[model samples]
Target: MAMITWITDDGRHRQAEVNDGSNLMLAATFEDVPGIDGDCGGCLSCATCHVVVDAAWAERVGGPGDHETVLLDTTASPRQPHSRLSCQIISRPELDGLVLHVPAEAW
Candidate 1:
């Protein structure tokens, strides 16, 4: 299992132990971490699972994919250089300590 931390817009933090091979969206939604709606499930269609990966872990997390990039253009929150769709981030042993920042909203 990997430990992932989510920091909400209101400055609240939530953490969950996610299994490897799953995605961040699933982990967050399963843990009921606020601010990540994941409306499109993990399809990369709705952009509701948007998150800003902590800068410290940016390179390890990497950037969004082509489909995720296009969908991110329509996110409710402004995109940051580190903005990414949580659904696109697959959990792995290397991501055990991943930290993500949730936006104010994700419509």
Candidate 2:
């Protein structure tokens, strides 16, 4: 299992233990973490599961795929260079302590 932490815009922190290979969106949803709506479940259709991957972990987590990148472009919040749709980020042993910061809102 891997531990994923989510820091909200209001400074609220939520953590969850997810099995390796679990999508970050499902991890947050399973933990009932706020700020990540994940309205489309693990699908890339909705940008509600948007999150800002901590820059330090960017290399490990990797960048979004074509589909995720397109969905991110529809987000209302200011998209950062590290912006990613959580659904596209699958947990792994390599991401044991991945940290994601939830944006103020999801669209």
Candidate 3:
């Protein structure tokens, strides 16, 4: 399993052990991480799971896909250079220590 951390706007950190291939949006919601609302159930339809990858982990986590970029534009929070849709990220060994910053609102 990969260990991931989600920090809220107020700095509340929620960590979880997620199995490989698990969609990040699902795992965060299952962990009861505030500010993450996977309204589309990881279908990539909703941008409720928007998050900003910590700068230290941005290159490692990579950027959003073309389609995800379009949706990122509609997120409730102002998009960051590292903004990504949690649904687009999957848990994997390489991302074991991934840290994502949750927006103040999920809309």
Q: List model 3 lDDT by residue over 1-107, tens digit each.
A: 88999999998899999999998999999999998899989888989999999999999888999999999999999998999999899888999999999999865
- Per-residue lDDT for 80-104 in model 1, tens only? 9999999999999999899999999
Kindly report which residue pairs in candidate 1 clash with one another: none
| lDDT by candidate, in order shown | 0.90, 0.87, 0.92
TM-score of each: 0.96, 0.95, 0.97
Model 2 regions lying over 4 Å from their true place: none
Question: Clashing pairs in model 2?
Answer: none
Winner on TM-score (1 vs 2):
1
Query: Could you give candidate 2's per-residue lDDT for residues 8-57 as a string of tens digits?
Result: 89999998888887888888888988877888887678798889999999
Of the candidates shown, which would achieve the greatest lDDT relative to the real structure?
3
**Weakest 10 consecutive residues of candidate 2 by summed lDDT:** 35-44
